[model samples]
Target: MATVDRSTLAGRRDAAALLLGYACAARVSELVALDIADVRETPEGLLVTIYRRKIKTFTEVAVPYGRIPASCPVRAVRDLLAAMAEAGHTSGPLLVRITRHGHIAPPLTRGGKQIGDPHGRMTAEACAEIVGRIAAAAGLEGRWTGHSLRRGFATAARRAGATLERIGRHGGWKDGSTALLGYLEEGDRWTDNPVTGL
Candidate 1:
């Protein structure tokens, strides 16, 4: 199974992006398109608003998990926010730019200002590349892409004893079957255990 360890990444932005993708079980497009305003901390947990480009609908998701490892999704998000604050980002897109040379920079406006770029969201291809790089750095082997993070989350959640109903709700799926077939295919490994037939 391919798992993401945010620590393996060289930059905070990369780590944060990977964590957001994994924890939210969100598409890379959603992750990169997310803005600081899209995140709202509620008493229940963190509420993330996902704007669907295809459907032209907004899906509000609540992440219930708390801080786990240093690379844990929640902690990683906190770290990402802190880094953004340090970079003088008060409100704007959550994920910014990280060059191939490992330099992190904010998106520039059309006027050439350093203000965050509304149109500078990462592409799906870039998202996939980021996932592949993180997986390789973490020593995981599998066919991984940006979609893998969402699949990985569903798979891991199910293996950890989360029911289909719960997983489905968490993923905002209309039905358990949809969640299983669409997002949690990796969880099928559990059904393949030789001991199960014994």
Candidate 2:
């Protein structure tokens, strides 16, 4: 996020998206589906309500403040909200597409013409593309999609000594998920390797 220039609206929004998405361990669909009204600020952190299509239910994800102010998800969200409000959008989509010229793109009609709706939420594809674009900008070699945030969250949390059950809950994974267990195994490999301390 340090590489991203927050001086522009697009940059600010991108930073917020990346931070919030990772902090919430959200799928791309859940991340993009969020609205300004879905996030509530608390004294400790943020409470984000996301609808899970897989389970067909709404779940709340708690995102606490980061130790670093620059990389803080809470701060990023607050900054984005302030910028959005200044741009006359106090509600609606939390993440919207901004043109190269920095104006929020209006919604398009089925006829491909711009519609009256000023708050045009970004598509899941666009959000994933943004993740890849930012990673490339940072000179990262591996493929980086929106799912990377979810995986990265699991890996990081495990490394930080978070329990599997807690990690799974944070990521909205089903109980005893094989996919969630895979991350725990991966996390352990690094610390438990026989090659370590060699």
* Best by the TM-score measure: 2
Which regions of candidate 2 deviate over 4 angstroms? Answer: 110-118, 183-190, 194-198
lDDT of 1 by residue, 16-131 (tens): 77777777878787788888899877666678888755446788887755556655566667777776676576677777665565444546666676564543456667777878
Clashing pairs in 2: none
- Any idea what lDDT model 1 has? 0.69
Among all windows of 10 consecutive residues in model 2, the one with the lowest summed lDDT is 183-192
**Each model's Cα RMSD:** 4.6, 2.8
- Global lDDT for candidate 2? 0.88
TM-scores vs. true structure, each candidate: 0.75, 0.90
Q: For candidate 2, what is the TM-score?
A: 0.90
| Highest lDDT against the true fold, candidate | 2
